[model samples]
Target: MTTQRPETERQAPVRVFWAPGCSSCLRTKEFLKKRGIAFVSVNVKDDTGAREQLLALGARSVPIVARGERFVYAQSNADIVGFLGLEETAAEMLPPAVLVERLDRVLHAAARYLKQVPEAELDVVFNDFFAPRALAQHAFRVAEAFVEATETGEDYTYERMMRGTHDVGPGDDILGYGASVIAALDAWWQHCPDRSCSAPLRAYWGVQSRHELLERAAWHSAQHTRQLQSIVEHFGGLPDGPLGERELAGLPLPDSVWMEASADA
Candidate 1:
């Protein structure tokens, strides 16, 4: 059955397809509620037709949200922040430049790591996480999108590559792979004149307001650095040393503060 928004709800139109007991779905609901944006929530399992409609949207995950014609599947904190244009509010929560920078560092490190290890060992690493064909495809997609997005200033086509695939082995390894992808993007960005460090950097902040973009960008970048460390541990095993505590301390503000601010708001 199709669900229509009430007259009041139509004033701030959003439609959220959710499944009960999904944490992401609840988070999406709460995020919208907090922003005072009116939304129509459809429990996909309760309605057969709604489930089909969701499938038609190319969404296979819970907490799929649509605002007018723009839709994002598999709601994430970043996705929600970007969609709602809450960069100003969430700016303190993330370091914007961190994503690109961390991406740069990790990709280079992985490449170096691969060089140090033998082909057989690399094969073992690939085998541990992904099929041979799948690993090659993923690497190629990451490299290609980094080039395309940098050259054209378009959205990275990485999302398209990830479609139809759900189990990315372990979450940690997937994140490490993501770091590698970001690294490729950074390299491409550095070479492309059309791509300013500032533009894609803004994505990390999720800010609609231009005035505070840079500050937010830096914070967003720093946050991703921490996340990348976690991803490394998931894939390559924990670091033998202290794992760069000084780097974290040097960041403008701790993630704790930004998280609290987002939560409080």
Candidate 2:
């Protein structure tokens, strides 16, 4: 006769069976951490019980994720991304208020991070591709285009702000630019006649809805903030800021915001 393991009460939203030195497992943990998704990490290599648990689930791979009684062996980041519903789809159906509120949180968070960039390093190109000044300008352009396309029903041809030849500004411009973005978002949110009103607007990148545009902007800002964080870390490690692990975990936003990809189209 075959023996079976009885089910137990779920103590967390997610449980990951992982092993040290496994790159995929590390990535899985980082993915959950990035989204503030609380999970119990079971190290299969160190604990006999955890190893047994993984085998019992019929999973031979590390980074096996469990939600409730169901288990899935993640083959790649895409698997986990899909399982977490991290892909943005059908956002046009969400309420306008929700979109606006999420956009506010993300925009403000990005600004807060950029504001802390040391003034002396603003013009120093980190990668020969982006400098603090260029990043700030790019952020402003994203917000500007969103408002322009939405209010006028015009096709805003999106370009790669990352690799553009933009005029340099004072390192402090990030502050005013961030404020403008927030103001524009507020106005757009207030005047949006209905959720369906902006559905017809299409960005040059082929994005079909205004909601997706806003969602993309939020993710884009956060991404650039991460880039700035890396630069700061290289300089001499970060000195306590919004991009800190704890602060990032507490940022308020809709759960679906993580699924909203910043990619064009």
Candidate 3:
């Protein structure tokens, strides 16, 4: 006779059979947190029934995510990404072929901005243009929304980003910029090989022109650059030039320019 896995055990990580205070469990928790996926962590030692569940699932190890009859041992970022269907979204949202192409234009523009701004004036410019923490939070929120919408078969709307409702001050410029960058990232993800499931997202973006999207991304980056400058000015000069290489490397650019480049191909 087959042993039945309890209802709670059937839930998810699907069943995070872990030992309490285990280092692996902690790492697994961190990974899930980073991806924004909610999971119930069951400590095998505390929950006696969970051990039976693990045994039935054929997992001798402490850290395992059981899904019904099948189970995945330990926490593998790739496994989690696969189990959660992250690749489909990556393919649909950001095709591997077009990745570098989209990134290049944005980086070039950032490089140019770095050259134009003086070291002493960087801080003031950045603060006046954008708030770093706020922007980072917004990006995180957007990413969470995308992940949720993708998983639940729902459409993630950015009406605030598009309509400029989130703009804090000065003619809704910052909100507009934020919306544009989100749009660009959405576009890149749509074309990616792993994110093909983001077709709905791609279709949603299709309504807007590449030029319009890129303009918003560029504007957003420019504002962010200005904000960085403000930081430098206030702090009495930055140690590393103006913007770090990593920051410049990740700037969002126009898709039209991306499409024309050989790098994406």
Candidate 4:
């Protein structure tokens, strides 16, 4: 249930709670910006009081859009539109099978990139969350979490997806994890009898069809894949077989590789 706001709160500006390296956060922020919607972009990682504010609204996650004590989880665009009273516009997505194929390619590329990250820089953090090993792990695990959720018949919680960031271990381990995730992805795709992915799945953010979740997983991984490539280039080396337009086509990827990841945000 949504908390009722004071009558005077109708004129309040929107507040977007987010963290760096969060794909959904980027999407939510961009969604508001594209419409020229004035919002207070709050970086939860940097804001000491953000968690308390979020908890007051019955949320304990990033990517939340709040007006006073009332808030909505900012994962589903449709929900965000409804929360903010914006016009609805459905964006087209690729076929479910094609999304699977593209996601597989993306996870493979992530593994390759992880192998190339310098050992010294693996632990070094950038953008608070862009430690090369972490980003590489995230790129693969984003989709792996989806497959795991599908098999386990469980809610795909953000906490579940974000479990192992602190202990990413060595570069070899990162690659190993990536390989295992890709394998799981392949196994799930091959054995999944329902290619249409129309079955509903519960997520911490909202309930949606498996196909919708898969699309989110694919695009999220693609964004991090691009980030991983940027990390490789940051160290002044070329990425081996970095993803191109052909590989990324039809996925709803953001235009900027690092979109507004500012301390000011």
Candidate 5:
């Protein structure tokens, strides 16, 4: 006989695929238990069916978190930390207006950091595929797609965003493009403040909502902020930031969705 959770506890669907001796798996379990959140636990090591299920879900690792149909195979406990929704100062706790304002500030800060990069280094490749222009263009595109999804309630696909704009470049107006991106994000949060208001996300990304997008936008720019700092370091330029040493060292990095999107790429 199976026991059912109280209706209130059943509202949010959460599951964990875990294995013994996996610290992250243990942390995820403890995280849910401490928060009074009801969740299904699957021990992939002890249960054959559980292992099969994890593989079927495209997870090769333990400590996979599933919020409804969305799955995050974490490299560290910090990667899935946003799902807690409990931190008082977290973006999820911010009022809609403030949240939108924060995105604008991040965009402006990124533009400022980009401007500090030497003109000659703009064309220098930092990683395998990203440079200053590619990174800025990506942020602009992501904001643009999210804004459209907010307005139309239609799922925005990567293919669709690339169709007409594939050949378009950022030109020499990186800051100007960033302003438009920030404006669109502001409009999105203003019109869609209710955390429950959700539209379909592109299946390729995962099942997601406006709430998830907001969290993503916050983390996304932070990732670029780190990258920009690296670029500054390479160019022997000082990257300015408000974060202190310990806080900067402890910054939580988002799980790279690029790994999951590789098949599509």
Candidate 6:
């Protein structure tokens, strides 16, 4: 007889699994709080064996919503609503063309901020998972990953986005990567036959239209760019062209710089 894993419990009280420097995690956390849904939040970034628990539950990334052993990737607000039985409608999204413009502004701003980071601070870990330099790189990577999805039509996996957080050093090298991603985004749009981006693509959270994902890409990177601006201030240097309300007008960004104060809430 073959041994089998136990059945997953689907109706249990909610448990949220998350890590630092994750945009989706922050969004999911905020959404739940705004809805007044009580949940136990677990920070896998600084906790021992918490990551192992996620692996056991078959989740390959952070921002996982678990009910006992059954978990869903909390990447899409719509998916979270369906999984938790919430009555909600998807928010009206900005057009892909507008989102592209927003992404351009965010990426350029992030590149400028990253180029100012000192080499000495490259390895300094802000939390257990990410460094000061990695934060800026992550901001760029989130946008790059979205473009990668458009080009490859593949599921936006966590590993693909976080793969290079440690590979590049501070300053020029990171800026180069961001420049490449910006170029790629422009090229893809110029050549794309459909500006609407109506085709659906598989993302870790749920199946979302290319247009929907574009908005995600724009706001996702913007959130990290906001964090990068704060880090620039921490290093006693003013960030060039810091994003303000005009740049961040429509993005659904959270106020907290890092993860929320209470990861256990």
lDDT of 3 by residue, 56-169 (tens): 877666556556566665433344455544543321223322333433333343334433445343222232223333332233233334434444445434443323223433
Sorting all predicted structures by lDDT, with the top scorer first, yields 4, 6, 2, 5, 1, 3
lDDT of 6 by residue, 1-265 (tens): 0123344544467889987667778888889999999898788877788899899999888789988767778877777887776788867777788888889899899888776766687657754446657777787888888888888888877677777877755453676777898998889888988799999988876678898888878888888887777777888988898797667877766666577434656
What is the TM-score ranking, best to worst? 4, 6, 5, 2, 1, 3
Which residue pairs show backbone clashes in model 2?
86-259
**How many Å off is the CA of 19 in candidate 4?**
1.7
lDDT (tens digit, per residue) of candidate 4 on 1-265: 2444566775787899888777778878777778888898888777788777778789978789988667889877777887877676768778899999899898888888877878898878865566888788778778878998999879999877876866676544777788888889889989998999999999998888999899889998999998888888988879999898656998877666775557333
lDDT of 1 by residue, 1-265 (tens): 0245445533456788876433346556666776687777777767569788787767666667776545665324556665655554443422434434533443444333323333343333331233322333343344434445445545433254343233333222433554555655666556645323344521221222221332322233334333333334546555333225333433333333112111211
Give residue 67's error in model 1 in angstroms.
7.9
Off by over 4 Å in 2: 1-96, 159-165, 170-172, 196-198, 237-265
**Which structure among the candidates has the greatest lDDT?**
4
lDDT head-to-head 2 vs 4, winner: 4
lDDT of 2 by residue, 1-265 (tens): 0123234533436788876533345546766777777787787766669888877777666667776565655534444655555664322233545545655665666676565667788777765445766765665566667777788878756443332326665544657766886898788778778665457665542445676565555545555555666566667745345443332332222222211111111
lDDT scores of the candidates, listed in order: 0.45, 0.57, 0.42, 0.82, 0.56, 0.78
The residue pairs that clash in candidate 5, if any, are none
**Off by more than 4 A, model 5:** 1-95, 160-172, 191-203, 240-265
Could you tell me how far off, in angstroms, the CA of residue 262 lies in candidate 5 after the best superposition? Answer: 16
Error of 5 at 24 (Å): 16
TM, every model = 0.41, 0.51, 0.29, 0.91, 0.54, 0.86
